[model samples]
Structures are given as structure tokens and as C-alpha cells.
Target chain A: MAICAKIDTYEQMYLIRAFEERIAELFSRGELFGTTHPCIGQEATAVGVVTTLEPTDVVTSTHRGHGHFLAWTGDVQGLMAEIMGRATGVCAGRGGSQHLYAENFYTNGITGGMGAVGTGMALAEKQRASGNIVCSFIGDGALAQGILHEAMNMASLWDAPILYALENNLYAMSTHVRDTLAGGIVPRAGALAIESATVESDDVFDVIAAAEQAVEYVRENSRPYLLELRTYRFCGHSINDERAYRTREEEDEWQRRDPLARLAGALAETERRAIEGRCRARIERAIAAARNAPVQDLGDIGKGLWKS
Target chain B: MEKLTVGRAIAAGLRKKLADDPTVYLLGEDICDPYGGAFRITRGLSSEFPGRLINAPISEAGVVGVATGMALRGLRPVVEMMFGDFIALAADQLINHAAKFSWMYNGAVSVPLVVRAPMGGRRGYGPTHSQSLERMLLSTPGLRIVAPTPRHDAAALIGAAIDDSNPVVFIEGKLLYAAEQATVSEHYDIAHTHPPYPAAVLNNAAGEQPNVTVVTYGPMLPVVEEAMTAAFNEDEVACEILAPSEIGPLDTALIGESVARTGRLIVAEEGPRSWGWAAEVVARVVERWGDRLVARPVRVAGRDLPLPTARPLEDHVLPGVETVRGAVEKVMLQ
Candidate 1:
């Protein structure tokens, strides 16, 4: 059972990597419109944290949220079509890459904005006594937003069932985390008296373990918890980033400990090869379907402005 | 007919909604017992529905943001901004998240959230506390703006706003909190458009055609009404007043038809003169009835300056009965 779960985790991470790689290629070829924030190196955090949530448990994500979306739903075609701006898109191509929604899944482009939103959702769940927890994801950059702190205080004070997953990728856009952030992220949550833990690893299994413990604590105690995943972005912030801030050696150093490669070592070479091939083929099919989908009509511009 | 003040009417409306729906919850600053909100609208509500009337901190943005989340998660959350001026703090959440959710998600979800704000200047709250900032929230798609006036049924309007699927910003006048909301009048025959928050129309009971169409909403409704009464009694000026409780998706059809009959227009608002609701009404009316008017429409609005703390200065800054009557006379002449 453990081995099967491990294989599923590895498969999910590889699928995200393949999807992002294709997105990058599509952007470079000018096949996709609008900007995209690819979570190339932060796949393990999204997969590990999201896979721990129940179907009733809600999750809120940020601008770079494709990894989270895919991990939770794994609807490659819907996401691909949405990103490609087709009528068959998740939000009918109106939300583009920054905004997305599913049954219990929500994504926003604003940094740290979902902190309050997730807390509110958790409060609602607590009131219902549904035993459902909410997991909100933000980056290290979101620490600058005041709404996050406000949300943390409210969540702790109310003892809302929520888990705040902060993926510290070391940089916010071109600025280094050290230059932007003043204090430690974990200690900041601790100052608010929110139960917190930090997992410094590129391994998917470690993230999953930490997330499981955090989710359990939040659900059991009906309290808010924070989990900090210390990782590195293997690719630039966005597809068109020039990568002028960091050195090639620095990139190479993080690349050596790639989460995909680390997980692949646990599997036999044949199994790893077979999984990678299948994921790549699935991504290709999604891209073809997205490309073939029709664009929305101009007359439908005012369709969803107000719910009828 | 029971003469209910705006505050009591809104409180009754909220109480009824809470009793009716289990999913309904109220979030606001000091909304519970001992401090029945800043204006006492939520007084006794806390005792009625324990755990439902949440006492939020001074975090305005968090209150609205969390309410948006609650709405997204199938809860009808109504938030109260201590003062409408402080709504500027929650602009990002209201404008970006709440307003955009329905459209952004392609109607996948709806935010049935109501943010009740105590607006307008009169109680000497100075700059930060006293303001008609609805103009700042204007023109936002998927966001409904409704303000109950003295002539309209405040409770019904609030009920409609809460029952709405989209996010509605319910603006309540601070002065109107204690004043009587007279839904009936003897001088003018009162009528309303269809439900889901309707525009209240006032015409002369004598069946005389009005010479000027005065369009207003919220706090300015009474001021315009008073001005029209003064103009009528003193100078035999018949002006039809159209005060819609819903201002954002404003029922411009009523305004246009009234203006077509009068052939002269006077739009009044409590906000500043530049790019206010008055401006919107004038632009919309002109666009609809271009080259079909007796004279150009006139707008009555507050002076474009920060409201001063002094009583005299504040009165000078905000639009008064005299200012509205002057506009009525000006439009009547042309």
C-alpha cells in the first residue's frame, strides 16, 4: 500500500512537471496568450499538501497555482483548455491562468489575499461541525501583505479549522527572499500563536508526512496551523523571465536535488521510464485538445458579469 | 402603516433573514451585545442568534474578505462596515475578489454577500468617518449598490439585497438612522417599480405634468424631496422625483421616461460633484435622450473638497436643500 501511494505521488509530481514544461514551450512558441507562473521546482509542496485534503476540505491557491490545481483535480484537459483561452476552459477562458475554481478548489492571483478567504471558509465549516478543514497556499512573497497577518490573528482567535501552507521558494519575482522578508516565516506564525512546522526538503514523502500531521492537528483541534515548505524554484518566476538574478551554478545546485529525480530513485528504472512516458503522452494529448478547442464568441462577453 | 426608522427597519430585515435562513450570518465590528454596532442596527441580534452575529475586529478588509469566503462556501454572510468611509480599506477585497468572483469564474459560483455601510455626513464624524464613498464603488460590474431612502421601504430593500445572488453594497444614511422612513405621502402619489429592490416614484397627486425630473438616491432623496416641496409651495413648480433603492444597476428606464415627460432634468447626490452618481445619471440620460430636451440637465452634489470638521464648513461643503432647490429652479427656468 505504501509503495502504491508512493508511486501515485511520483506520478502526480511528474504529471505537473510535464504540464508546466509544455506550458513553457507553448509560451515560447507564442501558442499561449497571457502570462503564466509555472511552479516548476515547487511541485512537491503542492502535490504533497493537497493530496492530504479530503474531498469536503477546501483549498485556496495563489497566482502560481497550476501545480495545486492539477494535484487536486488532475483534470489536465480542462486546465489546458482554460490556459489556452478556449470556450471549453474551466472558467470559459475568462479567468485565464490567475483565477480558477472547482467544487471545493479556488485560486486567486493576489498574493496573501486567500489567507482571509480560507479562514472565513474554515469558520463556516467549523460552524457546520462538518469536520472539514481548509488549506490555503501562499508564497514567501505574500508575507509582505497585511491581510495574511490579519487572517492569522482571526484564525487563531476563532480556532478555525484551517492549514496555511507557505511554500518558501526563496524569491518573490526577481527579489531574493532575504532582501524582501525581514523575519523568519515560521516564527512569524508562532508569534500569532498558530501551531506551525517547517519542512526543509525537496522530497515529496517528507512534505506529505508534514502535511498529514498538520492536517490532522487542524482537524482534530479545530485550530489553524501553518506549514512552511522550504524549497527552490527550478525555473524562473514566469515563462518569459530572463533569469538575470541568479547564477547558472545556483540553478544547477538546486537542480541536482530535483524532487522528481529524488522520487524516481525509489522506483525501478523501468517503472520510472514507463510513468514518465505515460505522463508526457497525456500532456501532449491535452495540448492537442486545447489547441483544437474553439474560442469564445464576442457576443458572449457580458454573459457571466452577473448571475441570472 | 407602521413608521419605521431606517435603522430599525434594517435591523428587522436582518433579524427576519437570520430567522429564515440557517446559512445566514452577520459579521461586523462590535455588532454584538453591549455595543449593538456603531449605530445600534445589530442591537439585540446577538442575543437572538448566538454564534451567528460575529463581533469582528477592526480589520475591515478581513471582515469583508472572510465574508466573501463564507459566501463562496454556501453561507449568506452580511458584513457591517463601522463607517462607510472605512470601506476604502476593503476596496481590494470588494472590488477584486467579491465583485469579480461571479464573472471571473464564469458563473460557476455566486457571492450572496451584503456589506451594510453607514454612509453620508451630518454627525460631525470629520474626514475619515463621514463620506458618501458609493461613487468610488460605482461602475463595478457584478457588484450591486443599493441605498434605502426615507420614501422607499427600507426593510424590503434590505431583504431584496440579501436575497440577491450577486454581492450587494447596502449603504445606509447615518442621519436617516433615527429619522422616520415615510413610505406613504399625501402631497405626492407614491408608486414603485417591480420587486427585487424597486425604484420609488413620486408624482403630484393633482395629476399635473412635472416640469423638471429630479433623480436621486440614498441621503439625497429627502433633500431633493424637501427642495421639490419648497419649490412647489413657493413657486408652483411640479417636479417628479425618482429615487431608486438600487443605484448600481440603476433603473435608468424610469429616469429616462420621466425626463422625456418633463424635458428638463436635475440629478442630485450626496457625493462630490466630479464623476459622482449625479454625473452617471446625467450621462446616461443624455446618452438615451440626446437632442430631446427643453434644456441641459443640472446636477446638485457636494463641493469637491474634504468635508471639514466644523459644522458651518461641513454644511457649506455638503449639498443642502437650498442647493437642490437652486438646481430645480435653474432647470425649471431653462
Candidate 2:
């Protein structure tokens, strides 16, 4: 069954927005450790693309990966605990926000390194004839990282079953995509001989339709495809970022097309309110459980360092 | 037993693992047949195991990152860097990604990946091609480093490294690839410490007292052995040699035990002087047995400089038989 068929993506997007908003509040209060890059405005991209994937298909995510993690695993408790540095965290409190791992979901803080890793995983699935594909999520900023290009070339040359889902949020920290990126986005993958497609919208359905096709191309052909999703980040680059790089008007413009509002606009007023109420309650409960969870023992620091 | 060169031995080890385990794979540049490997380590194995051995592009970081991905998917991958110096290009993958995954994921995943690189400067490969850069990788946490000597079965050690659950950087002495294998002789008693990834301990003459314990690894083993023999013949000084196959997660216990008995220590390596493996061995032993030594510990390593292309200049930068002999003689006097 399709993941979208089972759950309301509108609620999921609302949940991600509320969860990230709570995280920002927590960060302001010094409740969370390390730093976080929240995908507040781009929840639709995570929900739309991941819902199109199967449970068996693996995903390699980026530094700003909480949305992807939430959308894929739906383990809010584990993700919350992980962010709070608790022993019950998905990674046992070690990976924090950027580095996370589950059975089929993997993430690292490195911007573009996972591209190669995902390609390799797709190649492995192809070799095993497992009929599973991989979705490697990278931002437009990741184009500066040489490994992504190398990975794309390798994937095309090897005919690996993988989809490079590039979330173009228009900014890499203080710099816009125009300043860092050259030769545009889609053609970059096209130049590597990879099939490409693009979806430009805040609507989750548009992204889902495009993602389904891109994923099908990879699965059916047993080769790589590039899916470029144009989106925006409603939050700053990180918790501490001041947003000095852009104006309030620009933020207001993107906010008008905010995924949550767009999705809610399509729903009845009561339905939107009920979904928001449920998502808020669920997030609050996860936060409480995560906050009460014990910290990992420092004496066993080397516990997972090796497999023994 | 038919004697095999270090290259052939490594190939045999890889072949054994590939045949034994279905998940084991080989990935590198020009590793497939028609070209084999740059060092020919994967020579004829490609034909034997057809689709298992893959030839990758010149992208070092991509290859290693790909190998890490494969390892995460429950596959054992062994990647080869054409030259050890080129490992610098893949440092991000090996150090950041491969080394951090098992711990970062909190044991949810393990990368049983092996990266083999031919190290050491000889035969005028110039500054880039010929370098012992394994020292640069020693500081990486959760990363295992092994430089097997000819005295031990290189094949078995390589096999052990491949079987290891942790990511291992297998440093092959480029000079030792074609050299004839060395055998245990009657004049020495050979025993191993730490099974699986063992270190070879050669105690010359049974039950005899030694004045100094000389610790070395990789190609330096032969030079230290020769120096020990010379010191014994000339001055009747009995010296023990301990060659650890595993460098990081170093078995300092064995070295400390030998230091306790001998009360003298000399560490020799092929890499440059300061912050080299030699210093690490000495510091570890000294930290454990402070002020117990009769004289100051000596480090016999390459000169603190880049290896030049010229033969005389290169020879001067790198340590040889004379360098090892000088260290032994210097400590013997004190």
C-alpha cells in the first residue's frame, strides 16, 4: 500500500512544522544540545518524495534531515529522544540531529558524501537483484561538493538503481544558489547522462506525482534518475542564523506559499484544526518522553566504537 | 608450502575470502583483468571471481564512500588506492564517513570495509607516488590500521583484516610486494601476540637475556632484524624484535612486556620522524613504564623531510639498515 494512502500528508506536514517550531522554542531556551538545521518551510518535499518510496527502499539524507527522518520512519519518539541526547534516542543519543540511522534510513552531516554512499547502496541492491531502489537527498548547495558529481557519474556509468532527490531551497547558508551553482541544476545531472525531472510547487501532491514517476524510472530501468524539487526554508539556515542574508519581505513571500497553509487551505476548517490538535499533542508527548529519558553512560563510551 | 611474494599472498588472501563469503567484494582502479591493479595485487583474481571485482574511476573519495555504502548494506568491500599517497584524496570518506558510522549510528551499523594501499618510498616513484602515509591515518578513532610484515603470513593478516567488523586501512609496503617471503629460522623463536590480528615477536636465542627491545613494522622489520643480527655478531648483544601487524588499537601490552624485560626500547618506522608511529610506540611504552628504562628510548624513522626523486637524496631521507644499526648501537652504549 502507498504510504500516502494510509496517512494524511497534510497532517504530517503540519506535524513537521509544529515539531520544528517547538524545536526552535526549545533552542531559544537552551534545552537542546548541538545545533539543528530545521526543514520548516520544505516539509512538503520530504513528505511528498519519501511517501512515494517503499519501506524496503533505502534513503540517505543530509544535515537538514529531521523532516526526512520523521516522514520516513514516523518515529517521532526516537527522533525527539535523539535530538534531546537521550539513551532511548534512535541512535542512542550519539548521532544527535544531523547523524541518524534506522533500519533502512541513514543520514550524515556531510553535505554531499552520502550521494556516493547511496549510489553504492543502489548498486548493491541491483547486484542482489533485490528490486529495491535508493533515494539520496541532497540540497542545491551540495553541487559544490565534488563527491556528488563523482557519484552521479558512477551511478550513470554503472546503471545503479537510485534517485538523486535534490531539494533546491534557493540558499546555502548566507549565499543564494545563483552565486554558488553554475550551469543551473537539472543539466548538471543531465550532463552526467542521468535522466532528470523537476517539480516546482508547495503542494505535496505535485511533488508526489513527480517523485512517483522519477522513482518508477529508476526502479523500472534499474538506473539512476535526478528529481529536482524547488522549495524554500521558512526558518534560518540554523538555529543561531540571524537571516541577515535576506529581507523580511522575501521571507513573507515564501511564507504565503507555506506548505502547511497551502495544505490547510485545501482542507475544511474543522478538519485542519483537528489534525493540528492531534499533531501538537503527539509532539508534546514525544518531547516529554524524550526529556525524561536518561543520558547514556560515559563509562561505556567505546561500546559501539567497534562491533566486538 | 609454495612460497609466494607479498603481492601474490595478498591476492590469495582476497581470493580465499571472496570464495569463502558471498558478500566479500573487491573495488578499485584498474583492478580488473587486462590491467590488473597498479601494483597487480588483484592480478588474476578478477577472472576467477567475475562480477565481484569492479574497476572504479579515478575518484578516490567516491570509491571509498561507495565502499562504505556497500559495507553498510551487509557487504564486505576491499578497496585499493593505486598509491598510498592518494589516500589523502579519500581522507574525508575514510576518516569522516567510514570511521564514524559504527559509533555515530550507535552500533546500528558496521562498515566491514578494507582499504589496501601500497606505501613506502623506493624505486624513484617520486614524492607523491612513494610515501608511508599510514602514520597520517593512525589518529582516526574507530579505524583499524594494519601493516603486516613478511615474517608473518601476509595472506592470513589480510584475510583477518577483511573479516574484521571495523574499518581497516591495510598498508602494504610497496617495496615488499615482489620481495621473496621470509621464513622463521632456527636461530630465532617466533611467537604471535593477540590472535586474529597478531603481532610477530622474534626472540633471538631461547631463554637468553636481551639488552634492548626493538619495535618495528612493515618493511622496517627486515632492516631491524638485520641490525639485530649485526649487533649480536659484533658485540654479542641479544636484542628482541616485536613487529605488530595492527598499528592503531596498537597492542602496547606486548611492547610493554618486552620493555619490562629488556629495559630498553627503540621504535623504527618508514614514515617521517616527528609524530610518526615510532613516537607513538615509544610514548605508549614510556607512559606505562615511566623511569624504568636504563637509557632514553630512540626513534629510528625517516628524516623529517619530503622524499626527493634523486636516489641519493631519497636514500638520505628514508631510513635503511645503517639507520637501524645506529639506533641499536646508540642505545647499547648508554
Candidate 3:
């Protein structure tokens, strides 16, 4: 069963925020390998959209995908160990944070590359009558990629059951969506004649409501639907990003709409504290388990080497 | 069992897979009825398999990416690129996603995607339409490549490529579609689980010690054979031809054994001279036979220049039998 309840939605958002906070701390302490694009303030968009999906439903993620990935798979320990390059990671340490894949879940670092693949997955699903919808998440910056439009063209033309979720955090690594995007994300899909909907809130429940309608629209219409989520990231694009592009006032303004703070305001203080405590404890256990996980041996690193 | 053109053989292979397996489908630009394919390799198959063949939008990246997605979703999809040069647009999917899925996903999945692109420089289709861009993808580890020649059954090799678990980029020589011939009575089959390099050596004559070994494949196979025939009769130089159907994961060991016997090696290909498959073959030959080599191996390749649309210049660029023969004679003299 998929996560359809309001309290469960809140719990998922809390866990995502806690996971991102811990990941940030690990990055600062030089504990994690490689670079990570933290989805700090964009938890609601990830969790809300993923909540509407069943276990059999497929989702392709982006580089800043920990929130979306963890929300879908709920494998926090595996993800933590993966980013740490441990052998027991989700992808056996092969995929760091950007690249990861499970049975029905795929998260890659490529911006617009997975768009058509997700569309193709939906095509297969529809052809096989599997009734499993596919959702591929891309950043607002990926709007510039030509492959997305090409994929959306075919997905719409063929009426494939897939949802293209655009997590508009307003910044494609310091470049604001308004400054970089020509018209807007929705209009581009609209021009392609693909049915699309937009949600302009960071509230977890609000996103869930919008996602449910969009997911249903795709399933019934048997066509690709674009869901544009209006959210903001509290932190920089990557760990090293100082975010000099946006001013302190703007950052503070967006932080006011933080999903975590909003969820807390929506719930009673004691209830909020209890959920937050459980989320924090869950993240702590995940981190401890990940730190203790065995790492891939350096000597046997080329386990899948085919050609000499 | 019927004799068929290289193009028809490829179409036959696609037809067999589409008819035999419900999971097999096609994605390409202008691949539907009336258009078939730019090279007409997929000619006359869409009507037989209605709705299975898709005339894709002019999106190389989209076509390849979608096929890769289908492959990952447990369906085999054959993607056709109208021209091999256009594959440059699909490099992201071919090099990164399709090729890296199996290994980067830590052996959890294998992409059974076959991308068939018509490659070569004989046609005067200018710089964009003509050029063997397979050189760019030869370094990608997890991808398999098959270039069918006149000697091998094109349908069987293509079928083998389709059955492969990993991604396979099938390179059909654009010029060889009409110029070369393949016997249909011959059936080529290989296991999808483990497909090694399909390397074959054709002797110029039986019971003769070859003075030189000519390593080439695909479109150059028939051309190299013609050159060896000339070199054998006129120059009195016996030559051996080693053609490997699989481009990446090439069986250099086969080439090494042949070269160790012949002592001289020459690699001929339609791609440009620099950083092409021929150069890689030469490097491997030298690596396998360091000081035992009698002469520095020669590589017969297209001149290091962008292919032009002019017929004379195009012919001047792509390696011909005369050029290969000249190289073979030069290597023998050394």
C-alpha cells in the first residue's frame, strides 16, 4: 500500500528533512565521498509526489534526489551507506548520490537524460497492460535540455501513462528559474499539448492533494502529465555553493515557507515535537548503521569488468 | 535459406525478432511504411507488425533514451538512427545510461537495447550524414557493438545483438547495404548471457603461410577481401583477413595469434585515421607482440579530414582495395 494518510505524509517529510540535515553535517565533516546536492527545503515536493505512487510505480530521479529517492524507497540506511561509498549501499557503492537504481526506482545524476527513458518505461507498462505509471523528476534548470521536450513530445503523442514532475526550486545552481527559463515550465508542456497542472505551495498536504489529482489524470487519460511544484531550497545547490546569487533577504523570505516549520504550525506543539523526535531518532540510527556498514574492497573494485 | 542484400538481411533479422517475440519493438525516425529507414534496412516490416514499429520524432537522444527505458523495463527495443553521424546527439544515452546501467546499478539490471545505425563514408551525404562515429563509443565498456559483413549472416548477427542482455550498438555499413551480399542459408547465433567477440580469419589461399595479416571488419570486410585477392594474385603476397563482428570487447587475442604467425599487421576501416578502432587494434597488436614484430604495423584508414559531399573527395577519403593493397604490399616489403 502507498502512503496516503496525512500523518504519514508529515512523518515522511520530517524524516527527509532530518536525513538532509544529517547529510549536510556529514558533508561539512568531510565524512561523505564525492559531492551531494542537498534537497533541504524541497522535502514536501519529493515526499508528497512519491506518496501518491505505489511500490510497483516507477520513478526516475535527479542529482538532488535524496529526498525523492528516500521518500520512494524508505531505505535510509542503504542510501546513507551509498553516499559514503560503502559496499552495502543501495547500488553496492557504485552509485554515490546521483546514480541509484532498485527494482522499480531509478535515480541518475543526468539532468534531462532520464526523461525519455521514463517515458519509454511508461510505454512498456502500457503495452504490457501492467498499469504501472512512471514519474521522472527533473529540476527547473532541466527545462533547458532538448531531450525533455523531445521525450515529452513522444510521451504526449503516444498517450503514455507517465508523470513528469518538475521540482521548481527557482534555482538551477545559482541561476534563478525566471532568469534562465524563457517562458515558464508549464507553458512549454502546454505548447506541446500535454495535460499539465501546477501547485504553488510548500505545504506537504497541499502537494499531496495536487499529486493525487495529477497521478490520477495520467492513469485515466493514459497520457503524460506534467506536475510543477513551486518550492524553494533552504541551502545552496551543492555543499560548496555560497549562494551569492540570491540575497539574504530572499533566502530568509523563502525560509519562512519551510515545509518543516509549516507542518509544525499545522500540528499541535506536543504532537509536532513527538514526530520530530522520532524522525531525528530514525535518522540517527540510519547514520550509525551506515557508518558501521562494510565498505567495498579496493582490490576487488572491478567486479563487473567485462572487457579487457 | 535465401541470398539477401545486407539491408534486407538486417530487415529479416528485425522481422524475425518482432514476429517471434512480443516484447521486441522498434523506435526510429522515418522507420515506418514508405520510409522504412534512411538506408532502407527496415524496409517492408511495419505493415507486418502494425503498431510495433514507431516512426519517432527527429530526436536521437529521445529515441535512444526511450529504447533504453524499454530495455530496462524488460522489453527489447531496437533503435534506428537514420544516419550514424546523428548518433552524436544520442551519446549521452548510449555512453552513459544504456552502457553504464548494468555496472553502475551494481549488476541489478541489464539494458537489452539494440541501436542500429547506418555508418560509413562512401555516400556523398556531406560531413553530417557520412562518417563512422562508432569510434566515439568503442571505449564504452558495457556496450556491445556488431557490424555485419558480407561473409557473416547479417540477420543472425542482428538477432544475436537483439538477444544480448547488455546494450548493443549495431553498425550497418551504409555503403554495404547495396554493395555487399550475405548468404541467408547461414545462420548466426550467440547466447545473450555471454557473447564473446565474433572474430573470423579468411585465408587468401589454403595451405599458404600468410605474409601479412589484415585486421578489419564491417563495411571494410568485403573491401579488404577484394584487396587481399589482388595482393595474392598480382603481388604474390598471401594475406589473412581477421574480421571481428563485435567492436567493443574485441578479441585482440585472435588478432595476436594471426599476427604472430603472419608477423605483419594492417588495420583498415572507414573512420578517420586518428583515435579510431584501427588505432586501437594496432596498439593491441603491438602490446601483444612487442619485440616479436618484424615491422611496425600499418593502419589503412580514411584521411584525418572531415568527409566532404563531393563524390571524388569522398572516394579519395574512404579506404579502397587499392589503398589496402598498397598498404599490404608496403608492409610485406618491410
Off by over 4 Å in 2: A1-7
By descending TM-score, how would the candidates be arranged?
A: 1, 2, 3
TM-score of chain A of each: 0.97, 0.97, 0.94
* DockQ of predictions, in order shown: 0.78, 0.81, 0.60
| Top candidate by DockQ | 2
Docking quality (DockQ) of candidate 2: 0.81
Expressed as tens digits, the lDDT of each residue in A14-88 for candidate 1 is: 999989988999889998898999999888999999988998899999999999999999998889999999988
Q: What overall lDDT, based on C-alpha atoms, would model 3 receive against the true structure? A: 0.84
Residue A44 deviation, candidate 3, in Å?
0.8
Better of 1 and 2 by DockQ: 2
Worst 10 residues of 1 chain B by lDDT: B203-212
What are the clashing pairs of model 2?
A: none
Lowest-lDDT window of 10 residues in candidate 2 chain A? A1-10
Q: lDDT per prediction?
A: 0.89, 0.89, 0.84
In model 3, the Cα lDDT at residue A49 comes to: 91
lDDT of 2 by residue, A236-308 (tens): 9999899999999999999988877877777778777988899999999999998888988888667889886
